[model samples]
Target: MKILHRTEIEKILSSLDPIPKIEEGFVQYSKGLATVPPVGELLMEKGEVHIKYGCIRADEYYVVKVASGFYQNDALGLPSSNGLMLLFSQQTGQLACALLDEGFLTDIRTAIAGAIAAKHLAPANITAIGIVGTGIQARLQALYLKKVTTCRQLIVWGRSAEKTGDYQQDMQREGFEVSIADSIDELAQSANFIVTTTPSTTPLINVSQVRQGTHITAVGSDTPEKQELASDILARANLVVADSISQCQQRGEIYQALKAGSIQGEKVVELGNVIAAGQGRADEQQITIADLTGVAVQDIKIAEAVYLASEKK
Candidate 1:
């Protein structure tokens, strides 16, 4: 079997002749062949770790993903999560490829989702994008957004000023107009498209802080105990979508909202239904939210992308 590193995966994804529809790709995955254990957890010696795993098949190809996460404030150095992918031959059930799960596919797939959401949700006149984290997800979300929209200004925020400086330099090197914000409130007030990428236990952005018609993609919270926005935001949102409503209610940002009775059960819509039914934002002034906790089909879709890229090489 061939091994594809992070650089190779990124290169192939960037040079694609045509990109797949991320939201459609994810929705199909949700309804197709995907699996996850309802945000369950296991006890580790240091603390606790959450596991979410699954595989999906379409167009005669299949992809499998296994991801695990851990959060420890005291560690302060090691990454909180690790994942890997396995690609198999559909015709023969043979293992064809293996990926280090360096989060290359995961990051890109997520950024693709953000891009898709922006197209269907954000106002057409949105000029500034705000990112609330300086990590891998933040950078990828910013980079992918540039590909699918006209966002000219990018503002970033993080708890660490030094990390923010590093992110500023990195984005500037790519020719993106980048700035740093010390406060989440400042970033929320000015940005039309806001992406929250940090894994915070409490809500970082308040409902009043978000500008009218602003589109928010809450990306960081993939499990219980991880939250990125206040409960009230759900109350005011005109449109709220989820990668998976059942999954989101158990662990993602929407789950916290549901627990607080902020978002009613009837208000949540599936991303798949949105694409299939063309149920998008009703007006430009509508405040919309897309909560992505991820699904198994994305692994399958991205795995197909990886296999095709490998063949081309």
Candidate 2:
């Protein structure tokens, strides 16, 4: 089988249009054309591991991905997360390729999901965008935001003053008009489109701090122990959406809200359903929340995209 490295995958991703492909993946999943099995998980003291596998009907290949997030790795001069994807032929069930992406594919798919959430749920007249955390995801999230929205003002909040300042400098060079928020509350109130990228177990943004007509995309909490927003924040949201209802119930911000009886299990709408129906956000005044606990179908679709694109190189 052919083997691809992270550098090759990065090059392929630079020019790849993932929004449409990922959106189509969501549609196919919601229509029951994709078979996504339950995720296998392993909890680590510093982070966690997620094993996701899925196949799209009539697709040339199916994929299995092992993605890990070790928050403490950065101190060791290593990436916080890394993983690989294995592709298998649908027609013959033979190994097709191995993508040693080191979690780059997962990061891109997640960023795309964030952009999709903003495209369908964020207010049209956005004044500023807010980002929590100054990690790799923080950078990717900002880059993807530009793809879906015209908002240029970016307000960021990070626990580390040094890191936050560094993030500002790095993003400003990219022409983002970045600002450093003093607190998470300030960031939430100032930016209409907020993306939380930290792996915090405690809630950083309060419900009272979030302004009306704000759109919050919570992508940090993919594990049961991780949370970014208070349960009340989700409770008060006019609309609560998830990448997958089943997965959210097991983890993510939605899980916290559900466990606290703040939101009904049935009221949670899946992002796939939202994409397929082409419906989201009732009005500008209504607060919306998109809790993206990454799904296996996204991995499958993104891997397929990378595989197909690399062939043309």
lDDT of 1 by residue, 107-164 (tens): 7778777787776778877767999989889898888888778766888999888999
lDDT (Cα atoms) of all candidates against the true structure: 0.77, 0.90
Most lDDT-accurate candidate: 2
Model 2 earns a TM-score of: 0.97
* Model 1: lDDT to the true structure: 0.77
In candidate 1, position 127 carries an lDDT of 61
Cα lDDT tens digits, model 2, 152-243, are: 89999998999999999999988799989998778877898899998899999898899999999999898889999999998899999998
Model 1 misses residue 38 by how many Å? Answer: 4.4
Candidate 2 overall Cα lDDT vs. reference?
0.90
